[model samples]
Target: MAYLRQVVKTQSIDIALINETHCGPRDTSTATDVKTILDAGEAVLTAGDWKAKDPHWNATKTSPRGTQLLHDADALAFEVIGPDVPTHYPDQTAWVPDTIDLVVYRGFPGRIALDVLVDEFLSDHQMVVAELSDSTPSTTPTQPRRTIDWSVFQTTLDAAPSLPTPSNAQEIDDTAVKLTSLIQNALTAATTTENPKIIEDRLPGRLMKLIAEKRTLRRQWQASRCPRQKADLNCLALKVRRALEDHAKTSWETTVDDATTDWVRLHRLCRSLNGPLKHHDGSYIYSASSRAELFADHLETQFQPNPAKDPMRARRIETAAEDLMRQRIPAEEDPIYISPSAVFRAARLQRAPGPDGIPNLALRHLSKRMLASNGRVPRHGKGLRQSLARRVTRESEDSGTTTEA
Candidate 1:
């Protein structure tokens, strides 16, 4: 009782229950033992600082078995939440179990989602577990992962309508929206209905079931000591071992396939296997958005310029920019005339998709049609095009090379 009291106090348990306690035959003696375990004084009981309940405490109607509940008096309203099922078995070979134990809670009855007896058969008494919830269940459903076919994505993208030429800023905005929607729709259409084995390292369901059945059969054979049962258990054990070996081989092959076929999945699998990174305070950075925020904050703080610290250098840079703008420039040179090969190289260099979830390769194939109409710049972007042309001409002259219009 003293050890139990110390454990309760050390663990800060608000409620505790003891079953089949043979404290004493008399109510007065049992109450005295309860007081010692609860660490409650006469003054504390009078002030309602602690409360206890024992249904079989009377000396007149004495019984060997007794259950008691002790809790903080000021805590939430508690009572005996009962599943009314058998919890105790007499022996390992006993066919029937008896209900000689109960579970007690220190919170509202509504907080308990379930209370049940588990047939573990490890000991004479069955295990009792409760599921408690103070909040409502989440409404969002988990989305199953699916493989996307790149060929289908390309086909769908090619079938989409050609982008309209924009003459103004609103038309430019409208065109961007259309392209974004088209890309997203094509990606959706390309997604396969099949959800592959994402966690390849996990044991397959059939293998797990076989393993469990083998355990049960081994136990039964040990109890019965029958030669036929022993033979059956041995065969099951062999099957389980074979299933495990097959699963291991299949999992390794699947991991290799995923690493070669999908770079995104490979990256995710590597991160998962390596575990998550931690913040400065030793908390895990679990979500991608949180990690992005952390990186953004770090870069913002580390790279912020202190222009006042180097005033002379800042002035020299500004003067150089002004001088470069004042130099002589050609009238008709196209500054942003990017070659197809250069575009392809730039797109290929981007190994990961952008924040908008569009593949960088899409830009290489779609840029020419979207950026210009019939090989000419859109009307709204002509001013910027001329500005760039002047800049290029000035730079070309500075390099002692003439830019022909």
Candidate 2:
């Protein structure tokens, strides 16, 4: 039994069949020993004794312990034959083959059989044979081809040219028009809408008015103060400028308080001034100080000092400024020239001047500026020369006259 289990392990067959042990039917000692061998080998066990009747053979439950043996040779034979057995073999009776008790059991697909019967009458002992069937279906179908309408296909081909091609100019124009309308409508809606709840109900508009008054006071203080105080005033002015720019760009629903907080800082600065600042045009400065002082303070803070103030720093600033200006201003001559016809068409379609001596046309304004500067605007000399030559040739032909060059 140990040798049979070793053979099953080494050979790798699915089921192990043991036959002709020559053991007593009543004792079950050989079956117990075989089961112990099978348990150690991790294989299922089924057994039969040729001497035993009725039950034939039965497979034991697979487990770590040895399988329980049974005396049932007939039952084991029925399991071996499965459902494909005929009622009788040749002229033999149903129970004629009593000596040939079969026992069959299944295991993992790779276990080898221990011993098997080969039919000595046919060849040697009874042999176990396995046959495999290729149950796959055929790929090709046994059918004829279906007809398609050639006229329908031809009609589709003929209709292809009539389909609309995409137009980029039309799409761009539509997008531009839509964007313009949307912006205009949004602006109009913003103007018409009431103030949001937070701004409208909370401060009673007094906080915003106070902030504006404070900013005015600060501007006045900055204008009146001496050169030392100018830097602080300038910083305040910059903050104000940024705030105003932000306010301008903001949506209408933005709160007045949120928009005007920078103004409050300017107001605090103005309150520090000695007196109200007066303007050159006789208007009072934002605070109590003369207009000249205010203007001087503004210049001191905003404008960089001349080279005389600090020669090296001034020179560096001047060079940087020159480079910046050069970059900002376009070249006098465009690298890509415009066609004369396009320019002429643009000039011709320009609007006329208004009643207030204001030239509504861009070309007329440019021409006026050019004339005032004593600059010569380009004219089509070639066209004029061509027209003159044509006129001379027409006159000479009509009069039948010729001149030698």
Candidate 3:
């Protein structure tokens, strides 16, 4: 059992099968022992698809074992997959080769593309090889982040045509589109696309070598079935398990320390470590879209205003703000204007690109004439949306300033 865990960890096996378990009617000792190992192993290893209280596991716990027919259905929703050929080969003591090996999986049926028996002569039983393919669909498509070279980006932008100044609302829209496109093109020319780095195993050479030795011992014990060989294998398995535990602890500590200052990184790391997300009903969230929807729903619920609180008070405050804006506005349309200095200051700030995808760096390096023109206020209800204009008007009224607007 310990050697089984070693194989799963070293090989990064997502699913495993154990054959020749020697569990049958009137004797479930071996099966019970395996379950015990699994109970403990899951803590240090990855969790299994089946739960402890699964109907199949509970029903078969102490029941007399019967031969599992090919058409037998699994109560726990696991599908049994078997090769068309025999897998077990008895030594000279028996002439017939029997099919005792089977694979049980609970996932998308199309995931496993092939299930074949391989004659490797490693043991009496031929190895069962299952090939899996990633055919599941994802909701959101991810784009690789472009790694921009600031110096190259600056040079590219400098070599491009001068930004055009806009005089009206239509021109403003066109100019924004053109500016965003130019920045995007410059970013493409001066950048390389690379996906985020994933963490890999960094186990020490000594530990890796020990794992290899353990594998060799496991194979030897399986072949010989000698008490001495078993003892040696057991001793080595204990050592390997302890070493793996220590290495895991150290790795976790290091990861936490490095991620301390970056909450986003820390959050991602924790999610990866915690296994798959489950729905409120206990089923696993498989599709990326499903997980995303679940999160969105949860956030929506959290941000919703409390029904128990005063709803009238909120409406009154909003009404007061709207009334004040109406009272302060002049009969004639006088638009708000952002000074050139203010625009320059805003463009100089280090921030992410807006919804238009225009980065601050692009705005900062744009021509002074274009910047001044862009800062000029458009006629009321022309350049900005009504809601945005109202917000700005109310803010200006509160500040006792109308020239800025």
Off by over 4 Å in 1: 1-8, 12-146, 192-274, 280-282, 286-354, 361-405
C-alpha displacement of 220 in model 1, angstroms?
Answer: 7.1
Every candidate's CA RMSD: 17.7, 46.6, 17.7
Question: Considering only N, C-alpha and C atoms within 3 Å, which residue pairs clash in candidate 3?
Answer: 335-405, 336-405
Superposed model 3: Cα runs more than 4 Å off: 1-145, 163-176, 219-227, 246-354, 367-405
Which should have the higher lDDT, number 1 or number 3?
3
Using lDDT as the measure, what is the rank order of every candidate, best first?
Answer: 3, 1, 2
> Residue-wise lDDT of candidate 3 within 210-268, one digit each (tens)?
86676566666676788998788778878877788788799888999988889998888
State the lDDT of candidate 2 residue by residue for 31-117, as single tens digits.
Answer: 445444344433344544333333222222221111222332232321232112211111212224322233434343332222332
Superposed Cα deviation of residue 354, candidate 3 (Å): 4.1
lDDT for 382 in candidate 3 is 60
Residues 1-405, candidate 1: write the lDDT tens digits.
Answer: 467557646875443432223222243434444445334321111111112223321112112333333232223233443334555444345344444343433333234433444332334444555444433322222356767777777678777778777766567667767877887787788877754454544566887788667656756766778899878877776777677778778887988797878899899778667655666654567699989998898999999877577889899988999999999888696677889999897884664766777766554544345435323334546765677789999887877754342
TM-score each candidate.
Answer: 0.35, 0.18, 0.38
Query: How much lDDT does each candidate structure score?
Result: 0.55, 0.40, 0.57
